[model samples]
Target: MRTPAQNAHLALLLEVAGTPKPGNVDRHRDLEDLRFEHFLAGAVGAQRGLEQAANGGAVGPAFERSVEGMAAQGGGNTQFGALLLLVPLVRAAADDLSQPVVEAICEDTTVADAAGFYRAFDHVDVFVGEPPAEMEPLDVRRGSDAVPALEERGLTLLDIMEQSVPGDDVAREWVRGFERSFVAAERLAEADGPLTERAAAVFLSLLAERPDTLVATRSGEAVAQEVTERAAELVERNALETDRKIVERFADELVERGVNPGTTADITAAGLFIALERGAITV
Candidate 1:
């Protein structure tokens, strides 16, 4: 039998799978859409708890520690288990919702499977330009590697939100609206050109609070700038090399603790490699 937490997560997933999609809905269609929406809302609420845990909140420390311990184990680890658990949740949500929008999210997840999570950082490096000439080469490379790892980790965490919460229709509709808004804003930013520094800063400020905004915004330049600034800040405030090593060590420790880490490490490593090969560090 699934534990109470797992049961709760499954319940939330069911809710999101049932919500209504925007624009394409016909009132003539049955109340099944509405019921789905209701379930989706509840699932989203439950997912917040899961996200917090995945992101290193107090509630998820044990799980995080377990992941770390699994990483220590030579081949398998906690991250792999997390992925296995996560894949089913997302897949179920997609299957239940049967909407284009939900399918899009599933598509994105599928792409993630192909590309791995860390690939997004390549866009970030391109946005930020090159580090100062005086900065150590090792530091730059390590920093570059670290950014993608964190991004991949974040995506892994988002899997909980995407899969566990439920309401495919509602979530997809919300995603559509968000995309529309982001596209509009990006257009405005692009037209402004180099004058967009302030706009870029504002965008990043908003992104810090709402990362999802990037999906909707059309201005790759603006998004890139925001990512660059954020990455720089992380480098200045923390040692990228040290942080990367620590994360690796944590995974190692998790393995020693008897948790499976193979999936996370494979995904993370793949992402890092992709970023390194495809990413641009200089503007």
Candidate 2:
């Protein structure tokens, strides 16, 4: 049986997915793609939440308890519910795109990685004229055999979304309009100069602080040790630096609003998780 919270989350995903919008093809596709990607990332994050909970890792005990309670109630069914809501949105968004984009994605090694490409594609806007005169006619084909499970999973999501948000015409319209203006991927990739430098700087600042908290907050000695090691690896690879500055700035801004700087890690983690839960982040 689905918990009330899980049901509510499914309803929310459906509501967002059904948001209304104008009929422009580009805009409609963009919004649908983004909303779908956001929901998928949320599902991934939720599953990760369960893993982190079971391991008694770095997340707050309160959060772990919540996951435990949810799992106890119905055996992690919410994750499946989330998947049921995600598939139709993916198909609706992808069906209209150019073949090259779809082919490029299908060839990726993992479904998650391919899905990530679609998430990026949602923010890309390019105008390519009809196929070049010198090129042979495009031989596009759906390679369902390549990733049958992923394709089936995506379709299942579509079915769930359809069932949950059947009559919300207004929300659907909004989504259509939002998609038209979406430009996240292009903005992230092509932006130049000091902005990139600043993001790198911010990442480094946060990476420096993460290890201490990972060691202190994790419940199990082994988990703490693992997190500590992971944090070190992140620093060595400069993995967090890209987003560190933005995170720090965001943290500072929150502090200015009366949030305690001493609680920065907890607050940051909470905010990030909330965004994940709410489908604000596409990946």
What total of clashing residue pairs does each candidate reach? 35, 24
Candidate 1 lDDT over 1-283, as tens digits, reads 4322333344223212211111111111113223334333333333433343334333223222223322333222113222223322223332331235333434444323322222222222211223345422312224335444434454432342243222221122223422322332333234332312222222222333322222222233454344344434533544233454442343243233332212211222112211121221001
Error of 1 at 85 (Å): 5.8
Candidate number with greatest TM-score:
2
TM-score of each: 0.19, 0.20
Q: In model 2, what lDDT does residue 166 have?
A: 19
Worst 10 residues of 1 by lDDT: 19-28
Q: Tell me how far candidate 2 lies from the true structure as C-alpha RMSD in angstroms.
A: 21.2
Candidate number with greatest lDDT = 1
| C-alpha lDDT of residue 152 in model 2 | 44
Q: What is the lDDT of candidate 2?
A: 0.28
C-alpha lDDT (0 to 100) for residue 190 of candidate 1 = 43
